[model samples]
Target: MNTLLLHCRPGFEGEVCAEISEQAALIGVAGYAKGKPASAYAEFVCTEPGGGERLMRELRFERLIFPRQWARGEFVALPESDRIGVLLQHLAELPVFGSLWLEVFDTNDGKELSNFCKKFEGPLRKALTKAGRLVEDAGKPRLLLTFRSGREVFVGMAETGNQALWPMGIPRLKFPREAPSRSTLKLEEAWHQFIPREQWETRLSGDMTGVDLGASPGGWTYQLVRRGMLVTAVDNGPMAESLMDTGLVTHLMVDGFVWKPRQPVDWMVCDIVEKPARNAALLDDWIGGGHCREAVVNLKLPMKQRYAEVKRLLQRLEDGFAERRIKVSIACKQLYHDREEVTCHLRRLDR
Candidate 1:
């Protein structure tokens, strides 16, 4: 009962395992991570009795780069018959939970178990409720039961305040066909993750202006214009004519790295494919120079050390911002639409 289950993108199991091992060692909780490539999940078994819970407490979810979601629990092997009884017995031994989410890995094999989970939820909830193990109060912990197969399951728990908002840490996002490029979904997901929905109307209103560097074909630019903002799409390559027809876009042909906005704009966005360090430094300059109030930049990662690179870049941004006495909010994520790269959103609070 001292194993931690972590869900991550398929093919990133190695990164997840490495990150967990390093993070666990850093916190003085000796542990070993093990998972096969493309498993879409990994596990860390601690050497100490209570080390599992301690690892969870020490590692912040926001700071973890590879794992989308995590939970501390033990593996429960189920008998072929009386599976429900076995599960109910385990639930009885654990504390009452506010919510229960039955999930599987984000892989093809995992998707095959989705129907089972959906059908199992009803009877499981009924059983838990009958035994008084289910509580609807939001203050209680969230129980996560991840099934690798019908015969095996991992029972874990996470504090509601610290856990991910969705099951398996994936948000349901639909792409708009009207957008010129599929890259539009990256920016859309960025806003959902970085900016609170309640503040959208006030913070992303029509009166605001934005500059989209590397705006060829107008993927990220579409989001700004859709929100009814006047946008200057900066790129040497031609933009989509449909985007220009909106009568709110000004396309400028120039190098995105060297070009500077004539005046301070409400927002700045860049999706240039370059080194992560360069992108991080560019963001620091953008916010530090007060070129734009906010910005979203993408960093294309290399073959190895992806998590380490992200950590270093974030620290660099923090150090630069502190040196300039700039008050800002910065968030980075590997979006569902993003591959081999991460999106960073930076907002400067000072006028």
Candidate 2:
């Protein structure tokens, strides 16, 4: 009777969880409960109960919830005998240690998530039981929005505390997915939201041009070409016919970093499979030598020391640009479709 909880990026929840199910079963756990859009939590009862250690080994989820299936997410193993109130007590560690967020699915038929929050409110608070995870003396709560497909939910959590209640119903697993881009990594498209399309558009003095490194199959280039910009796609491989057809792209049969642009372009885009410093230096020469004005690039992370590698890459770029008094903004995030890696946005200032 062990319970397992799961969480995923909002709009991509269905797809993410579905992918989780596939990944989980492959790792041996089975019989995952389907998510009810109305409920804040999704349940998985492992009749065989593979245990928490197993889940962690298999599922690379953000977090794993257990006990009462009030689980916010992570497919943890829960003993069936765990009580609801006791679960809340166990949940106390959540507010203190974990990054807790209240997820409400009500905006788009999110009544179920709200209902769970309300119905479980008593036991949940009681479960907190004077351990005092919440900050009563503090200011307003902190929250953010999460979405899956097109359905949206508000995520809130007590500041200084870990657990907060979801404000809404089970999110209806309703919205259809957008057209699939090749490779689940939609870093280029996701970048549009972090920084406005307008920032790139307006700030781009002229109809800017760009280079899409590793531009074969063209996921990154597709995004660039769609923006009405021309791209020099550098790769030995042929570009995707669709991207090539866009007429906004030029396939350059050459190494991306080694091949310098004939003249300066507005931007440099890369999703090349290479070491971080190599990519960093490539960007350095382009922006450093004033070859391009702005750039959006992806530094693929290897299995080990990913964060540290990225940190070094950022530091190097900053040091390089700073030496010349160049200004830039850098943003990084674990995009909905990203796996074990993060996407970054870097904009060299137009000083």
What would the per-residue lDDT of candidate 2 be over residues 220-248, giving only the tens digit for each residue? 67667756888898989877787777677
1-351 per-residue lDDT for model 1 (tens digits): 588888888877877888889899888998899988889889998989988889878777766767778888988998887778998888777889898889899988899998888988899888888888887978998889999998898989988767666789887877788889989988988787678799999878899999998899998999999999999998888898999999999999988788888798989989988888988888998888999998989998875888788878998899889988999888776666678888888898878
> Could you estimate the TM-score for every candidate?
0.92, 0.53
Model 2 scores a C-alpha lDDT of: 0.52
Q: How many pairs collide in each candidate, listed in order? A: 0, 31
Q: For residue 262, what is the lDDT in candidate 1?
A: 79
Score each candidate by Cα lDDT: 0.86, 0.52
Q: What is the lDDT of residue 155 in candidate 1?
A: 89
TM-score of candidate 1 relative to the true fold:
0.92
> Which number leads on lDDT?
1
